[model samples]
Target: MDPSMEHLLARKKSSRSSSRTRSSSASSQTPSDQKPREEKSAPYRDPRYETLLNTKGVFLDTCDLDIAVESKNIPETLLQGNQTVPESTIFGEHQFEYACRNLQGRNEARIIQDISRLLVPSAETFAMLGSKHLEKVIESVNEGWNNCIPLTGTRPQPDYSVGFRREAFSNEQLDKLSPFIGNWLSGDLSFFMATYYMYFPFLSCEVKCGAAALDVADRQNAHSMAVAVRAIVELFRLVKREGELQRQILSFSVSHDHRMVRIYGYYPVIDGKDTKYYRHPIYTFDFTTLNGKEKWTAYHFTKNVYDNWMPSHFKKICSAVDQLPSHLDFGVDPLAETGLSQELESLSTAASSDIPLNPAEQQVATPDSSLCGVGAAKRPKKDVCGIASDCSRSVTVNHCASCLNQINAHPASFNIFASRPLR
Candidate 1:
């Protein structure tokens, strides 16, 4: 089955998780009463991979997978290692907790202010709508940001011509976009932050505000990940347009729920099946920290990354277009195709702070408040096939040996978090 179909077949945990499921091809064809309730719309970090492009090995066959748990004693050589904590600016578990404290609670105005501050100072070639236009944003969402806008920052703001909003594509627009989007047609789902030119958005984001300001169900739904993947497809289309003005590289789908934000950059990567390049997830950032306001540091880190890498992507694309007899003529190393990513950065990476502290452990700073402590938690599923989740179980990959082995393993320990048997 398609990975997307697998998600539809799987039982939903809540309402927020089901936001897109309603428009799922299978959902509309089936009675709503027969389908699982969509996950509640809560302010939480969701990490479930919904599409084939995103997920690897999901036990989809509905076959029972019962593995006898085996424990392996750590090797003495492996046990000796440096216990140094990661010191990357993008490390953010504590950062999320601190940022939340700084906001106090569901303070959307503050959130905008923080985002604006991050964007305005840089000399980057990007323009955004000013505070006045941003104010309209809170009003547009049905659940408006229930806070007054504050006069912020002394620096000169740009005469911004573009702004983004949370909008769902109308039927007409969807039909127009059908050719570009391929099999990923999600219906009427709202975009969180989208920049528009002449009412058309080339890039999009699905934002999730992590706060206790909502119900438990709301705090647990990270459904935006699925939405972001779909949006990336649209962003990819924007860059591939026929006009010279359209062939740009910043085209990407952004999913930054403040805490666990993944920016899936579309790049022409070599999928093993063919030597042809395919656009896939390239840039990712996960700052799972609790050191107050540090989580927002990712914005700064992103700006730095953009300053460092955006041009490289463009240059590489241009080099191909130039079509020199060979890269040797240009005096640029063949390996310079993806400069920054190849040298200083990773094309696909996930970063979590070494600090063992989790915000879920300390629900809220204020004792008298009602906050759903749903920190960005990663609940990896166990496979009945006993293959590593990353292993696709395709003809190309081999069966898992760990699943077949049993040394000093404790079966009960493996079952602690294990749920459904693979069918």
Candidate 2:
């Protein structure tokens, strides 16, 4: 028998025996007791109540990047073809090659393995229910308020506000520290759009608030406020534990200014140390206007909440920014650019397919033959768009044969494909 096969069989036997023991124990419980037992084992148990357990260092500091790239050999398959480059190779000008070389090395590969081992478990826990507790609490509070208010007349509104803050990581630092994170930002578009929509509203809301303050009369409101505050704190703690909180975040505050309510805050870098206070950029949000008067409002909730309240706001922000139009155009598209016509050609071809496409079409239209098969396709010929051939006859054009074949295979479909208007 093969030694590896024997080991696997032995492990399977042990797992089966252990599972049987657990099953038997569970079966022995009384019907009444089963609920409690299940609750204890339930995945939804509050992660806040659990201790801050460091799984793996998904939140890589500069030092970790150095170690991952320098001391631990890791492969940068995407950046470079080499598999034996140091993780620190990103610090070098020839980062892609360094990453590729390191990727070939066994020692460097361990760094990603270690990161995966740590990140996967923690992510699972966070996904299960660890992250939602705060949202649930907030929802409950909102529901409670709704129940207490009278529908017929103008009821007294509660004086409350919420603010958020996040720390920043430099582009250089992100490049060196975790290129995977950078890659994720580059690859995901919807993630960035959602973030933009989310924060825009909140910032707009805070702008509307514009230095207003609120007052609470009874102890009950104060207690409810305290509960909300505690829930926020717990949310932060959970984010920290899950390795989601970034060093920078957006912070928000809600207050009253006598007659009108207000919300205010800023996105700022959270000082790594305890001694330094929250330092915000000069541009803070104060959304006090609604038709030029103060009224109840909600801004981009997700972006503000994630930026301010979640510890992993930095990561989220980075991920979100990666999805932004600016980042995609500058960062990923250049490296991933095959050529103009090819990209348009791909889009033209994709549009012909029966498969439903994203409503927000990100793919650009290009000539089928011009794609380099990397990123965006090159723009079509000026002449094709009605420009005279004499305008730029000297300009060289390249097209991809494979993309042309695709277009040729479906000429009827291609002819019908209309060019989308540029934004």
Candidate 3:
């Protein structure tokens, strides 16, 4: 070979060697030295109690209730007549003893079932009783209140929830009221129509056991009770009674961890244009602390809520409904007369079939949902009517200023309900 050709070949070989050395050095570099791979951002986590309060621009403060101080402070009327078990006997004492004796399993469902079977009154048993007032209210297990805070896209399903039975109100009355107050104003008649028609829900209970933290229970109760109180406030607002609370305690929520139970009263403070929800301590009972003597304390409280609080709540709702103008000032809904029945049927059919009108906006709890986990996935942007169309806010051309304001505030509800057709 020529000497010049041999020199070129050696130089080419040297260049290839340098390239291999550089590649090897890059491969062996520390993570810090290497350009990092782009990470897909984590999904937005679900809002807990405090986070929910901040996000919705609501304030949370605590208050002490007069009746919560002592068992004697409970109204005799509340403690007496309408109880599932006799007022004199200790409620759930035997079951409490049994639970204490057995090595209680950590299964959340079993814990809740045991608690419900022993402590909480079943809707069937309570309703079957001959009592005048008790028969009107019922309890639901693991059913989410459909008419939750419009701002929160997902509904917080409590372990146990209570509301008035639909039979308590006449269909004709609901029919007349559904036109003006239905749709987005879930705080009104639509709440009952939206979910299982468990009208005017006033109480909820959250149960936690085993590895499940009571803190998570509190957060769940907070979101649920807030929604309950807000619905009450919305009803009052319609009747021009929004700011007229004789007592701020509008609703109640109970948190249970085996033998430990805590009760909270939820209320709203209207600060100018915005409404703020506050949680007040009602009572806390630990059956283990007093050698099971205080086992009946929670029973008495629940009885009072069922007997006294429920009647008063129902009365207020009736008064508000009576005050609604027979003819709505917001012109006329084409579906007013037959709307309630048609909508109720449609909702029931949809619920039974388990088919959502729009799957994108459905509130589904992911399996991985934990103490700090994300809830229902983020939904695609919806139009003013909540449909996947290009409907604009200006489409509220027919809606009154007051109606428009409510629509703007609770876009989620309007999106869900506005598209609902009446027969």
Candidate 4:
């Protein structure tokens, strides 16, 4: 019998027992020639039954069922109910609970399956997004910061110094900026920070140091850098199409010894194409740290243009990464080309050959001990029929030994083994 059917049968049996117990306690008084007592004297039944009856319009001022039926909203009514009859009561709570539980389980299973199917593709999409952001940052730096300006002992020097301080925007003021400008920059920045912090919490201080280095006294250079940053931010905003324009500089510090300036800030990101902004977790990493410790490095900005916009651009990449689906399994049919059916057929044929034919064939073959061969030497005389022996009854059949050994030898091969059992 189907497991589901068995479960339903068990539920029905339990419900019937409960119903019998409930009915057994009712008064056995019979109607007689005498007039009935006052209406209030009627025995009270379960409130749940009253609720169900009321819900069915059998005993209430209003009911969803009556509205649906009278309005011809529903094509059919599967349940029948009346006020006095227990079996006629509609909408049993126990049954509804059971159905809800079952439906919830099914929905959870489907969601898990969908996530598994999406995992790898989502990861690849995120990687591509990161690559595009990186490329844009590189382009911005090359176009905006090809020449260096002198910062120390300057006499009517260049307009911008590499390590000078520039004005910074506050969260409230940043929000008041142009929507496109603010959202594009701030959202991307938030995403970058979230990704960084999730992977490298210790790099928070270094990030502030790097951003501080970009603070310049030269307004022209600062404007140019901002423009470059804006362009990259717009690219990501256009693609994601969601997220907030809010920005908050968590901290900012300068480090002349390392020729680095760092700033830590929070920005939102486009979670998907529809939602405007989603605030991701925090992140922190330094571009200068990547120069020598390449392996430990989280991100790289080859040119100063990228360096200026790094915080926001990395936010886009991180958003893409976070949005990735957690699990995936492409619908590649393992049985289609696995040849498992043919292998099973061969095994079945071999097992069948051990079974004795009719009486005539058994008499002709007669108990040939020598023909059993060395492989069967250890077998008992009555069990020399090879596959004819009921392996289920054997104490040492080693049903999973060979498969387990193969899995141990080549771990990657487990995918195939796992697929086989599923088939």
Q: Per-residue lDDT tens digits of candidate 1, residues 357-410?
A: 221111101111111111222333223222123432311001111121110022
Report the error of model 1 at residue 326, Å.
21
Residue runs of model 3 more than 4 Å from their true location after superposition: 1-49, 57-60, 63-98, 103-105, 147-151, 180-194, 210-212, 332-423
What is each predicted model's overall lDDT from 0 to 1?
0.26, 0.24, 0.51, 0.23
lDDT string, candidate 3, 186-257, tens digits: 122132322345666777877766324555666667766776776677666666687665236777777776
lDDT of 4 at 366: 11
Instruction: Report the lDDT tens digits of candidate 4 across residue range 85-200.
Output: 12311113334234323323233224223221111112123325563433322111011121111111110111111221111223442232222121111111111111101110
TM-score attained by model 3 = 0.62
Taking every candidate in turn, the Cα RMSD to the unseen true structure, in Å, is 24.4, 27.3, 20.0, 35.2
What pairs collide in candidate 3? 385-415, 386-415
Q: Name the 10 consecutive residues with the lowest summed lDDT in model 2.
A: 4-13
Clashes of each: 36, 87, 2, 38
Candidate 1 — what's its lDDT?
0.26
Higher-ranked by lDDT: 1 or 2: 1
Worst 10 residues of 1 by lDDT: 148-157
lDDT of 1 at 63: 14
Candidate 2, residues 1-423, lDDT tens digits: the string is 112111111000122322343365444632211123223222212332112111211111122112212212111111122122123433233443343344342331243332211111122233345454223112110111211111111111222222221113455533422211211111111101111111111111110111211212211122223222222222233224312323222333333221233332322112231111121222222222333121112222232243234444334444544432222111112313434455456554643452222222111111121211222325553211111122322222222322232232233323222233222
| Top-lDDT structure, candidate number | 3
Question: Which has the higher TM-score value, candidate number 2 or candidate number 3?
Answer: 3
